[model samples]
Target: MKVVIIGAGVAGLSIGWRLLQAGATVTILDRAQPAHGATWAAAGMLAVTAELEGAHAAERDLALHANALWPGFASEVEQASGVPVGFVRSGALLLAPDAAALDAMRARGPVLDAAGARALVPLLADGIAGGLWAADEAHVDNRRLGEAMTIAYVKAGGALVPQTAAVRIEQKSGAAVCVLTPRHRYHADAFVIAAGAWSGLLGDIPITPVKGEMIALAPPAGAQLPGPVIWGNGVYLVPRDEGGQKLLLVGATMQEAGFDTSLSPDVRDQLRAGAQSLIPALKQWVLADHWAGLRPKSPDGLPLLGPVRSGNIFVASGQFRNGILLAPAIAQLMADMVLGKTKIIPAFDPQRFAPRFV
Candidate 1:
């Protein structure tokens, strides 16, 4: 089968790779460079249990399944592209700024005193009352991962068209036949809309962009920050130690601003303050970079996967915060659906929100 995928981010690229492996000729179209959307700005956390505390049972199970698939997925991508994605199962540390926060963290896992927390992360501030260590969580360097996926997809015989904006899906007899673009039209047996925040532009999918701002910091000379990810007080400090760099990613501020990628000075200062409050030694580090990306969010806070009203068109967007963690599983599920070998999960069906086709 010939398949055309919209949006060459992680979802579209990964799905293209899988479809190519399944003997389908694939073409991926993107408005900009691949992986320049939410995938590039994410902190690549695979926190299976820590992020699923208040989530529904189906969501939790899906997250766990995705987490289980990461090790193999990372290995495959690395081998295929001959690039290291900096995948690490270094675990995560959850900090509590006060007694109340400590109590809340204790409910999730074993809480350690200030001294114990300091033993794991020496730079932790004295104001920290306690912490909870989740040893099963993991993280990946998302920038490297995106590059590797792009290389693998192209090497596997998939075509990528950058800077091509898909205006809409052209249909005939109630079936999607091609994707309409400004300069060209792409015809295929199947169409997959994997556009992140821009999925709604083609049809009536209920997806919105949630803007997030983040800052990167370089540690002082001869000083190592910490091993695990630090989560505390609505701020997360992710350490990137691979490739001979001791950089900490401190983020992020979530705002409902529409399609704005500009950075804010106030948000940068707030992120710096929050990072220093958690790790006092960061005050001596240098600010390396700051930027923003828009996350595609749905009303139910879960991804919209599988076929929509258009018989041959499928959607694999609205992954919100867990897009990185869920990419591998989503690619497999989407490929299976395209091959007519699997059933869609009821909770994530696109029709749940009454999607309209143009």
Candidate 2:
């Protein structure tokens, strides 16, 4: 099977790796550097239990499956590429400082806690109201994972054509024939449109962007937060490496913003204020960087996966906030489906978004 995957980010690269392992010819085409998009910017929180809210049932299961695969997948990638993805099992702290925040956090207890109602994370700042401690879920250094996956995919004999963006998906005889790029027309036995936020703009389907603003903070000298990833409503912090450098990633303002990825200082400050309030330890941390990513989010919050009505072209996007968390499992399911194997999750199938009743 010859597969041409669009977008060389986590979703595309991981799937390419699987397909190549299955003795398939894989070529990944991207408009920019591999994994440099949202993948590079993501905080790499693999916390399925911590990152859930009023998400769809299908989305929850898909995220859970992907979260389960990260440990083994991380080991395999590190072995293949000689690079550690900074995978951490340090668990997570769902902390809420005040009454309002604690109320919201407490509401999630029924879903994340073992008992009918209880606090998960053990410690409290005396006034720390309530939260969940997800010991099984954690995070990865996404930057390392992206770089590692690129190396792994290449070592697995996958061809990567960076800076090559597909202009459109061309159809012939009621099926996708070739992906028309500005420089050349590339055809393959199959095509997987894993083009992140740009997947919907492929002229075949309605893919939209969900803007997520993030900030990175490395704490000052002789100061360190706990090892667990901490979340308090809108603000969350994940420690980077074995130091005080904790990357603060938050602010998932879900508006129907088109593809405008420019960062808003107002939004950044608002996020910073919220994070500092939750983790007062964040007050000493200096802001390292700020950026925004337009995550591909669908109407139902579930990713659009499986073959499209355009034929021969599969859609693997609309990951929304869970793009980083869902990468590994989504790749496995898509790769298997493309190779005549059983899909890892059926609800992600693109047919669910078909126009007839979508």
Candidate 3:
């Protein structure tokens, strides 16, 4: 089958690679450089329990399944592309401000006293009353993953067209037959919109761009960085080793601003303050970098992973913040669905918000 995917982010690239492995000819088109969108901008936290504590049962199960698939997926990508994606299972620490919040956090993981938490991360502020240690949590280098996926997809014989923005889908007899672009028309047996925050702009996918800003911090000389991800103060500090240079990535301010990726000074300061609230010693850390990316959010805040009203056209978007963590599962699921090997998940049906999309 001939398949054309819009959006060359992680989702699109992974799905394309999967389809190629399944003997389908696939072409991925992107508005800019592939994976430079949310895929590159993510913190790469595989926080199944930490991030999905209050999530719905289905979403929780999906997250767990995705988490389980990550190790194998990372290995496969690295072997295929000959690039390291920095998949780490270092776990995470979730700090609670008080006893009540700590009580509520027990269900997420093993409860830890203040001293116990500080033992794991000595730099933790003294004010932390207690915390949860989630051993199942992990993280990846999302930027590296994107680059590796791009190389793997191309190596797998899939066509990847960069800077080629798909303008619209042309449907015939209630089935998508062509994608109209500025320079050329891409005709295919199937079309998939995995365009991250830009999915809704292409068609009626009902995705909105939620802007997030993040900052990279380098610890002061001779100071130790947190061994694992620290979640607290409305932000997360993810430790990364970029070519032996240790850095802590503190993130993410969610704004409903549309498609604006400009960095915010106020947001940067706020992130630093939040990180410092969790780890006091960070005050001496140098701010290495600050940037932003837009997350594709749905009205129900769940992924849309099925065919639209137009039969042959499908959607694998609305992943929001979990895009990196969910990439492996989504790629397999979407590929199976496209190949008629699996069924569409009802809760994640693209047409769930009916009239709004059609």
lDDT for each residue of candidate 3 in 129-245, tens digit (9 for 90 to 100) = 878888989999999999999999999999999989999898776778899999999999999999999888876668999999999999878988788899998999999987789
Worst 10 residues of 2 by lDDT: 113-122
lDDT of 3: 0.91
Best by lDDT: 3
Per-candidate RMSD vs. true structure? 1.2, 3.8, 1.2
For candidate 3, give the lDDT of residue 332. Answer: 96
Stretches of candidate 1 above 4 Å error?
none
TM-score of each: 0.97, 0.89, 0.98
| TM-score between candidate 3 and the true structure | 0.98
lDDT of each: 0.90, 0.77, 0.91
What digit string (tens of lDDT, one per residue) describes model 2 on residues 1-358?
Answer: 7889999999999999999998999999999999988787677888787767777788888888888888899999999999888898887766655557656665555334322112433332345555565677788988889999999999999999999998887777777778889999888889898889888767546677877788877767766545777776567777777333455455445556787888888888888887766656666778888887777877777788888775578888888778888888888888998886875356677777672111
